[model samples]
Target: MTDETWSQLLAGLTNVTWQSLVMIAVGCLLIFLAVSREYEPLLLLPIGAGAILANLPLSPLVGEHGLLSVLYDIGVGNELFPLLIFIGIGALTDFGPLLENPKMVLLGAAGQFGIFLTLILALLLGFSREEAASIGIIGAIDGPTSIYVSGILAPHLLGPITVAAYSYMALVPIIMPPVMRLLTTKQERAIRMPYSQRQISQRTRILFPIVVTIGVGILVPFATPLIGCLMLGNLMRESRVVERLTHAASNELANIVTLFLGLAIGSTMGGEAFLRPATLAILALGLLAFVLDTAAGVLFGKLMNVVSGGKFNPLIGAAGISAFPMAARVVQKEAAREDYSNFVLMHAMGANAAGQVASVVAGGVLLALMAG
Candidate 1:
């Protein structure tokens, strides 16, 4: 070979390192989980694809002015995509169950205990306050909120934190049932909470978003963008006059943004950036946060049982940590195992919705606490 061609070959070989190969393997593993295991396919798939692309030998995706970098600046770095996604989430959530039972808000508040507890633990393990706070938010189990908070708090740690949050969220069905069953008595689980389907009027549904946006904005201004966008989506759904916009927001807009956001986030996971002992520690801390959040929520439910003269089932408490319908459904399944006739879906859903809001507020609270 000519000298110039040999030099070019050597340069290319030098760029292909073990770290990149390992990260590419990790990326493929994420894709396998999403595809074969059906664990958050929508997100993990795109994320895995991005990781592979970014780690490719001599790829331009992570270079200066590259597509991933540009997308990151336009969406995640500026904190635009997550806010947009929040709007879609809001439009999709039915707050009627939570509105019908405002008392469930307390359970949601209880769910945030793990965020703070995990924060302290992470700090002790040598992470910076901001990094620890971001890691702790994994307990919230709300992907968008975790992204929003971490985007603002510790942007550097966003990729792993977001992945950990969503991964554990998909695992809620597996993680929560054993904890729920262990904490509650079979008698308690058998106590039936019938689905009380209250017909929430269009007016009420429309007003709910506006009122919550205003209320939450006043209480926690940092949550305004996330809450406002979410509520706007719900308003579109309830108004029933903007089906096009609703469809676009929930389906089209959300899908496009998810793709861009996942790619941008995955680019941040370049081998040199992600192959740290700290990354493993963050993953471990995230799992700890998730388990503690469940424990705290269940314990609070046990407290409510005492206060309510054993009227409330502690299993519903497991729904308090913002994993949404998944955690709620898990609770329902656990309840059914003890007694086939018992169905706590509605009540669990109420706590689940409450958790959704509480997690945003908790993120804001963490931000406020740390920023101060």
Candidate 2:
């Protein structure tokens, strides 16, 4: 090869700009958060790596025929990865906690209060109706739901929305604690919720996914795809005969989809896409969205506590934010901080699980409101 050929081969290195370096540093910080802080490592690590790879000048990981580009076209662009991931989430999820105490579903619906609240805020900040609606969904705290909603309503903002959604989700353990403590007193936090030893029949468990899929589909057709995939995975797990499928969906399929989803999202974090005033607004609104969700859940929990004559611990309400086991675990930890034997984890799980379902419904409602 001539000297000109050597220069052409090294163009990526030669053309590296200061902006790219800044983006690379940001990616490194994400990696550090994954490795040292152990914050959503599975997502942050891959996403961080993808950001670094994509930010390189003339990145081979983007554009037509690029590996990340192909992955995006295959899944993220078509909005398949999030749905696939939901299947895995359903396969791994335990709905028994939710089924035992159906009342927890109320907290789940209450938790979605922030999404609409934030939608107005985003609109006030100059985002269009569709953009504001997409931005508001960051409160869902479920990564797939955020991706699914944003990809539909405002695809241009998907990058920042996805980042804000996932990052705030990882921060749930932190964001929830102060709010939970502030909202409930020591006496309230010490309130104990008796675990329902009620057993859910195998038949009921098997019927749940089918019933949910049908009911939710009929009610909000926009939600059918999201709810359908999720229930399908759950059905596979509940069937008992499909143990192999369940295991694969929960493990192999989930892991692979997570990686691809992470890379696709990170690829969107190109220097031009991410380092903008709009990106900053998204991150800010996302934090507010999560905070508001937790607060709404806790306030409503407090109201229920009053109605139940102190039978309810307001901390359980914080678990209603669709953060899954993490939010539930946080509620349990807060309770344990007050009383070691204050075992409300199961109850919290019920609410937390309800939030999981309610969040998707809320997303569907948003879609119907905006697109329909």
Candidate 3:
């Protein structure tokens, strides 16, 4: 064989490291969970593929001019992809439920308690304030928000934070129930909240996004970018005149950006960056944040129940995290398990919708606090 051919043959093999192999395995595990367990398949599958490609010896898909790097520069680096995703999320979200039960906003605010709690814990464990804040956002269960915040505060930690945020988000149904049951009694679970079908006028619906954009921008200026894009999509959704735009934002735009974002994120999971003591701490802390968020919401719900003379179902508080309809559905399912006749779906939906907004604000607040 020619000298050149022999060199080429040995190049990839010689470059291989145990770190790369472990990362490849981690990537495959993510892929397995995504395909077999159907855990956040949209993001995880692409992330796994990206990780594999990036770790390949002398991969052309990495480095300064590579596609992954370009995607990272264009989207993740500038925090554009996550903001774009938020637009789609806002377009798809239904605020009518929250509008019907304005009081549910309290539960949404309560849901964010874990982010701060986890931030303090992370700080105590020797993480810098910025790093801890980035880690704390995992509690919001809003992957886009986590990405946006972490990308700014501790960009190096993005891979683990994003993974933790989405992974726990996927596990919301599994993780929340135990905490809910442990915090509340069977009677609280069985409490029925009759759905109030309040007539939310078209004007009110149209004004919500606009008012929120202005209000949040003024109050939490750092959050304006995230909230603006989110509310822009929501405004398009509620405008009715922009059905085409809304549909595109919620479907095509979201899907395309999601693909790019996932790949960019996965590319960052190179073994040298991902395998660390801090990474494990991030995962553990992220889980704690999620649990604490759920616990705080449920405890607050219990308080509301007492204030309402036992009329409020504390399970709805468990829906106050940013898992959207899924968290709300889980609450309903749990309530039904206690008593087949109890119905709290609508009420839970209200809290869930409120949580969606609350998470965005929480991300912004973190940014504001961390901003130099």
Candidate 4:
């Protein structure tokens, strides 16, 4: 072969940087975890694949006008993907639990305290305000909200912040139990919450999303896009007339957008940006935020237990984050381990649903505070 031809053939190998190789390894690890552990495979698998594709030596996927870049511009840049995901989340969400138990909203609100606390801590660690705010949203464990907020405020740190959010989200089943056990005794863990079947009227169900969208939009203007899309899905579901539309939103639409969103986010994880000391700090801070949110929720549950004269199960407090049924399921599993007869799943779902809405509001609050 001619020397010039050989150089052209060797271009990719010669261009490989240590950073790119390391990122490729990281991508493979994410893929392994997703496949073996089944930890959020829907999003993680695509994210890992995108990371690998973007980091390949002399790759064109993330170059100007490339697929990844175009996806990023179309969705992540304009904050379209996350909003669409919220619609799917809303369509899939059953607010009956939360509506039946309105007081669970307080627990959801309490769960978010860690976000602001982490924001303050991130600022203390010398991160700029926008970056710190973005870091703190990881506590919510709502990947879409994390992406939306970080994409707008701290685009530079979006890679780490997105990974931290989704990773902690998948780890909720693992990370929250210790905090629940540490904060509560066996007796507290075994606290029983009987399911109450309140016949929430169809009218109430229809009005709930509408009321929430208007109220949250009025109160937290920045959250309107997130809340609006979410409630639109919920509204479709509750309306009961748009079964086809609802199904499409919750399934087909969500699935496609999730793929696009994950790839766009992963494309941002090039090693030159992701391997910095700040990445480590973001990961550590994200874990801290998760722990703090869980602790705060359980502590608040303990307080409610006191106020209710021990009628409330403190374990339900642990579900007051955006992990949805997973967090609630974890709480129920922990309670069952303490006493097989204990059933807190319904109550925990109430708190979980409330947390879903609360996390979006928290993201908006952060944006409102930091948008200046």
Candidate 5:
């Protein structure tokens, strides 16, 4: 072959830069974290693979009409994937425990305190209002919600925000245990929350989603889209008439969207755009947001515990950060550490579920504030 043809064929290798090499290494690191540590392999693995592909020069996968590019445009760009994922989440969520103990919603709201706090921090650090709002949402600890909010408010920062959000989400088991221990006494951790089984009628369950959809939609207006889809999935599951649809939404649909969502998110991790000072700032601020979220939730739990005469277990506060069953399981583990008989998983799940709702509401509030 002619030298010109050879150079063209080896273009990707010949034109490779240090930045590309670094990003490829970072991709390997992501894969390592997924495989070795089991840190959200479903998300991290696809994201890591996509990152490596995107970093390669003249790579077709990230260019126009490329698989990753098209995926991003169809899924992340229009903000469809996260909403679809919400349906599956809603289908899986059970609000019974939350309804039985409505007060636990306070813990959910408290968990999101970090989003606003971090907003101010990001503003102080010279990020624009929209950008700061997007940055602050990393505190939600719900990857889809973070992506949805940031995608709308600051598209440029989506890649970093998503990485921070999901990375910390996977580390929830690691990050929250210490916070729970530090913030509460052993006795407080052992505090038993007697499960008060409340019978919620099918009517209540059906009406619950409708009521929430209308109430939150009217209140936060911007939250309508996120909450609406979530409720739709819940409605489908609770109705029980659409068994096939519910099962599909909760499993197959969720899986397909999640895979594409991860790849789309990773495709945006081009080193030229991603490797910057702002990216580092986002990483630091994301951790700060997580710390602040856990702190606020635990402190709120402590206050509630005092008011309730020590009936509340502060460990449940860590569940308020919306890592879903993972946070609830961690709370249960911490409770088990104190006394094996203490089963706060239901209560923790309640708070964790509430955190999911609160985070979306918080995102809407941020959007409203910025829009105003």
Candidate 6:
């Protein structure tokens, strides 16, 4: 072969490294999980694509002024993307269930016990106080909350924490049901809480976000930005006149921000940065927090059951950790196994929605406790 051709072949072969190859494999695995296993396709697809691009030899995606770096600087670094995503979440969420059953708020608060508990555990394990606090928010089981808190308190760990939070959130259906069933009796699961689909007027719905933002802001000032943006989107959604804006926030805006956010987050997973014992520990601690949150929710449900003369199903308590509709659906399905006619979707949804708000509040509280 000519020296020019031989040199070109040798150069190509020299560019491949074990680290880059492993990262490419990991990226492919993420794609498989997202596409075939149907696990958080929206975020995982972008993350996988970013990882692949970043790992490619001589790729500019993670270089200065590169696409991933620019996106990260503009959004993740400034904590804009997560807040934007929160707006979309607010626009999409129906708070009617939570408003209809205000008492479920207690279950939501109870579900956050795991955050403080995990904070202590992480501290004992030798993580810095800020890092521990950031890790503890994993128990909130709310992706935007986790991202927001960690972004401010511990940006370096954002990739693993974000990935862990979303992955566990997706697994809520699988993780919660068995725990719910084990904690509640068959009779309890069979107890029916029929849906009362009250027609919430547009005025009431629009006012709900404003009222909540004011109330929560007064109580937790640090949560103002996250809560305010979220509530603003909700208000737009319910105002009955901002249909175009609401649609954009909930769909196009959300989709664009999600892509940028995921790519930027995944780019942070360089081998030297991610291949650490601390990352592994963070992963384990995240799972621990999730389990503890589930346990606390179930226990609180049992307490409610006792106080209400068996009217409340303890299984619904397991839905109170902000995994949202997945946790709620798991509770409903588990209840159906005991008695096919029993439908607890509304009750579970109440707890689920309350859990969502509570998780965000808990994230802010943890920040206060740690930063104070």
TM-score of each: 0.97, 0.97, 0.98, 0.98, 0.97, 0.94
Candidate 4's residue-wise lDDT over 1-372, tens digit each? 999999999999999999999999989988998999888988888889989999999889998998999999999999999999999999999999999999999999999988988999999999998899999999888999999999999888988898888888889989999999999999989877778699999899999999999999999999999999999999999999999999999999999999999899889999899999999999999999999999999999999999999988898998998788899999999999999988888899999999999999999998998765
Clashing pairs in 6: none
Ranking by lDDT: 3, 4, 2, 5, 1, 6
Which candidate number would show the highest lDDT if scored against the true structure?
A: 3
Q: Candidate 3 on 183-280: residue-level lDDT in tens?
A: 99998898888875999888898899999999999999999999999899999998899999999999999999999999999999999999999999
- Scored by CA lDDT, what does every candidate get? 0.87, 0.92, 0.93, 0.93, 0.90, 0.86
Clashes found in each candidate (C-alpha, N, C closer than 3 A): 4, 0, 0, 0, 0, 0
**lDDT tens per residue, model 2, 14-87:** 98988788889989998999899888888888888888988989988899899988988899988999999999
Residue 7 lDDT, candidate 2, scale 0-100: 100
lDDT of 6 by residue, 164-213 (tens): 88877777777777677777777877877757777777788888999989
Clashes of 6: 0
Error of 4 at 283 (Å): 0.8
Q: Give the TM-score of candidate 4.
A: 0.98
Report each candidate's C-alpha RMSD, comma-separated, in the order given.
1.3, 1.4, 0.9, 1.0, 1.2, 2.1
Candidate 2 or 3, higher TM-score?
3
Error of 5 at 139 (Å): 0.5
Expressed as tens digits, the lDDT of each residue in 320-362 for candidate 5 is: 8888879889889999999998899999989998998898888
What global local distance difference test value does model 3 have?
A: 0.93
Better of 3 and 6 by lDDT: 3
Model 2 TM-score (2 dp): 0.97
- Worst 10-residue lDDT window for candidate 5 reads 95-104
Lowest summed lDDT window (length 10), candidate 3: 187-196
lDDT of 3 at 39: 92
Query: Candidate 1, residues 236-325: lDDT per residue as tens digits?
Result: 988999999999999999989999988888888888888889889988888888888888999999999889988888988888989877
